[model samples]
Target: MNAQTVLASSGDEFKAPGPELFEFPPLFAGGPEWLTKPVVFAVFGSLVVVVFFWSAFANPKLVPRGVQNLGEVGYMFVRDQIGRPFLGKNTDQWMPLLMSVFFLIWIWNIFAVVPIIQFPIASHIAFPAVLAASVYFIKIYLGIKHQGPVKYFTNMIPSGLPLPVYFLLVPIEYLSTFILAPFTHAVRLFANMFAGHTILAFFSLVGFWFLFEKPTVAGFSVGIIGVLVTIVMTAFELLIQFLQAFLFTMLAAMYIQSGLHAEH
Candidate 1:
């Protein structure tokens, strides 16, 4: 059968439940399928980030130049604002990881607007989950490296609290910081991107649907409204794109900071 016929037949399969704006279909739909658009977009996004940075920084000029200057400013922002404050003595060691997270996230979010490839990879849960896990692993490793295994866990919990309070607070703190925190961190970025993209998709599709599907006086008016809403949502998504990337990097740096200062 043709594409439209298949979609029409599988109404139940394609229908999105509740507030989920986009249903799984059209290959690009965020789903458990083998080759989703988000996954492909993520792979391309990684390459783009790598190539862009490499081209910008490969042949460094003593005097600042085009892309290199812009890149240096970004690096300096993270180093001076985020890494140096938290990492202090060991800032240089962790700079690469922090920079990677920031750029990867920023590139992925920016892809939401670029012409043909319109999906943001960070919208996928798996991508952010992996990033969060990476940061968590690094934090744990740092903790172990600085203070031995026994002391690491001990240092994690605050010392001044009473014994009874320790019993409740310790586990809660551990579970929150160690267990639940990473997943939530990943999901926060994913959910925001996913929801934002879905809204844009809904408005854009509805606008076109009204323009073509009916072609009446009221339909024309509704189509115009939908188009306007889509434009507004697109503008909002642009802001969110930058904000989410900044927030993700900021939180990652904070998490690293927490690990560094766990002893105090």
Candidate 2:
């Protein structure tokens, strides 16, 4: 049966998840209108990252213990997988920024599956856009500071291109480096989280509707499949969340590194 027919017959109509899923009303009456679920979750996500790292690193140890060991593992993962590869010898200098971006984005995304906090903050495009913008500005500032503004844009043009080719190549490089880069960076993270959460919600709703809300002979099998799919998607979403965080941080590091050294 079609989704509409199934939903109609199910007694409780199923609401297909979409952007409406991300829009939440205020937490309570008299609260600030902007204090919606995603905003609260975003703030809490930042606090969670800060607190976890602080608690992990607060006490000095000859050998790591408790949270510190776990913290070290995460630190090393981000360093090896993201910072060291891109930043090279300067990796240590940029560890804090890279680590912060990694954990913050990760925790923000992990919130998607957390009980009672099932919203991915990055699914709100503005959040990722702001972060990408921050990196973009930093890239510009660092490039200008190290290479000078004139040299920065000038160096952005590939060196080996013939003089006449500047007509074609300069505009392409300018657009790619200065404009499309940040836009795609933000949208990549936002779109992945947005699509992942929506898929999870849709499957979960299917299971809930077919199994609990309206149980029937034919619908029962569909409900089982829904439950199975939801479980699989949740596991996959967790992997995507981690990968996206790593990728975002890696890109940030690459941008910073590019700013520091002009590409030949």
Backbone N/Cα/C clashes per model: 0, 0
Tens digits of per-residue lDDT for model 2, 1-264: 655666667666667788888888899998898888888889998998899889899884879998888899999999998888899999999999999999999999999999999889999998999999999898999999999889988988768778999999889888999899999999999999999999999999889878988887667777888899999999999999999998999999999999898854
Stretches of candidate 2 off by over 4 Å are 1-13
Top candidate when judged by TM-score against the true structure: 2
Predicted candidate 1 versus true structure: per-residue lDDT over 99-123, tens digit per residue: 8888899899988878887878787
List runs of model 1 lying over 4 Å from the truth: 1-33
lDDT score, residue 143, model 2?
Answer: 93
Candidate 2 at 44: error in angstroms?
0.9
